[model samples]
Target: MFDVIIIGAGVSGVSCALILGSAKERPYALNKKIGIITHQKASSLQTAVFNNAYGIPAGKLGSELLEESLAHLSSTYPQVEQIEKEKVISIEDDKTFYKIITNKNVFESKIVVVAIGAGNPMTIEGLEDFVVPHQKVPAIKNRIQLKNNDHLVKDGLYVAGVLAGHRSQLSIAAGSGAAVATDILSLWNDGNHTMVHDAINK
Candidate 1:
């Protein structure tokens, strides 16, 4: 079983994966089996331009940002598995681990983060009870977000990115993802706050 599984490929999802999979510092790293399942598309792809994102160059395509993020995660943390072009059908809590059913395969994990964005509402069995209207974007009807407390939907499950009720901004979504990962790492570190800081070799 994987230690954690993230269900999205947007900026938020990729950011979470980057933090959780980082091997820069051993004491702060999770060093667990992690997997990210994606449909190979993110709502950010629809964005015309991403100029306000902190640290990102102005006038860059959203797709380019996503590509670079994915490339960075892959090259930096090759141990994190990426399952692409697959749709997650449902998630079942098995007491000990979560049984994730996808159109292509079945996987089990100790924790799951839902960062599927707020564009189209995708229904997953057993998660409907937490569904609520997307209040951040009132003009977008039918958009939804999961009820969460500090990104935690319930024990072992979390909601991040715009789906976690954050504004649909690149920096906000990415930061939310990293925050979720830090929370998970804290749990692994016995409730102590943990952070990953890489020191450059001089």
Candidate 2:
């Protein structure tokens, strides 16, 4: 079991995981199968480190921030692992731990962070026959589960990053990941075992 489990390898997930690492917290990432998971890539959302006062820089953000975050995490904790190329089927929570099931593996952790680019898939009635129904995790309030399904757990799941922003930029996603981690760490150390929110929809 992991102390924390972060989903996706995007800036949001990666950056946040790095912070936990820096704080001496060991975390795991359930990304795709790394090598087999085609096109699993990362881009820094640093807004071009140096840009004109007029606007955001259009340059490609590299590994600077991510590298720095990694350095901190590596220095603080020695056992952080990034699991790649795994498609998550669902999440189950029971206050003490979250069980994450992927196509190839299953992982257990105390905190579940959702930094996935967007919310999960949603299924509708009319398009049920025409297209495959996309399922969203259940029990999401602070987190947006793209699906209308009712089977997702309501506790121990944190929905943040691109999923929270309906139409925000990528930079927001990066910060969201870190922010979610901050909240989780805060609550974890405060002796509060709740999921950070009183209600899933409120």
Candidate 3:
């Protein structure tokens, strides 16, 4: 079981893993490889998007930041592993941690961060019936009430970005990731897992 399994390899998930896995005194000091389960391929951030949004000279864009981040992530934490092109179907608890069941493999982690914003499954009527369940058959308004449903046995689960149901921007997602990581780390420290507890606990 991994120390932490972060879903969705978007900016939020990556940022969290980047920060938490790089800690020094942590036993899992090497990143947990933080399971990356996504249905969609992590789109290369268009340099145009950044440039157009932030006036970044329009030329210094395209996968550079992501490339650098990925490189740094690899070089900085030599032990952390990254599994791309994996889509998680469901997250169930395995006593102490969560088990992520994907189409290709299964991963377990003490903590789970759900950063799948609009990426989560949605039932559409016309053509995308197979995407989600019960497309034509309707009950009321929203089909399933997923407020407090936990069939899994995990103890710690965090939600961020759109998955957290917050209409968040890039910076907000980054902060949210930090906050969730801090919370999980706090719990980990309390569980006598690491030295990064004080920063999170306080």
Candidate 4:
């Protein structure tokens, strides 16, 4: 079984996977196998024209930034498995690892991060009202809310990114993703993991 599974290929999901798989003295140091599933490119960012994220010059297209980030991620993390072109059909807890059924394969992971963006509404039992508030527009709704500390969701499930109500900005989404990854790492360390401001410092 994989150690962590991040479901989304957006900035947030990418950042989370990078942190979990590339950190020098954390998740990667412990040899965790991370799997990232995406049906297409990282996110709508590939086509976004935004130019407001930190250090990403005012005129730099979101697509360019995403490309650079992805290239870096690939060169730096060899243990991160990218399951591209596969959409996750369903996720269920089997009393241990999560059973994630995708269009192409089924994966089991000790930890699951649902970083699915808020671009589409996801219907779930009891979350009907929360999924799609403005049915007319049908595009903007908070995906899911996590308990405090973003933990203990069925003993392993975690949520991050726009779906978790974080700002849609690439930088903020990336930060949220890293935060959730840290939380997951902490849990794996038996609550002994301390947050590092940045990987360079640690």
- Best prediction by lDDT: 1
Quote the lDDT for 40 in model 2: 39
Which model, 2 or 3, shows the larger lDDT? 3
Per residue, candidate 2 scores C-alpha lDDT tens digits across 18-50 of 555544422222221111111134332434352
Please identify model 2 stretches exceeding 4 Å from their true place: 25-58, 61-78, 119-154, 191-202
- Global lDDT of model 1: 0.84
Name the candidate that leads on TM-score. Answer: 1
* Residue 155 in model 2: lDDT: 49
TM-scores across all candidates? 0.92, 0.56, 0.65, 0.80
Question: What C-alpha root-mean-square deviation, in Å, does candidate 2 show against the real structure?
Answer: 10.6
Which sequence of candidate numbers ranks them by lDDT, best first? 1, 4, 3, 2
Candidate 4 ranges beyond 4 A from true positions: 24-29, 123-153, 196-202
lDDT of 1 by residue, 74-178 (tens): 899889999888888899999889999988899999999988887565657778888888878775466788999999999999999988988778889989999
Give candidate 4's error at residue 53 in angstroms. 0.7
TM-score between candidate 3 and the true structure: 0.65
- Which pairs of residues collide in candidate 4? 9-42
Q: Write the per-residue lDDT of candidate 4 for residues 72-179, one digit (tens) a residue.
A: 777888678888788877887777888888878889998888777765446222223334332222244433443324423446777677666655677878888998
TM-score-best of 1 and 2 = 1
Residue pairs in clash, model 1: none
Name the weakest run of 10 consecutive residues (lDDT summed) in model 1. Answer: 22-31
For model 3, the local distance difference test gives 0.54
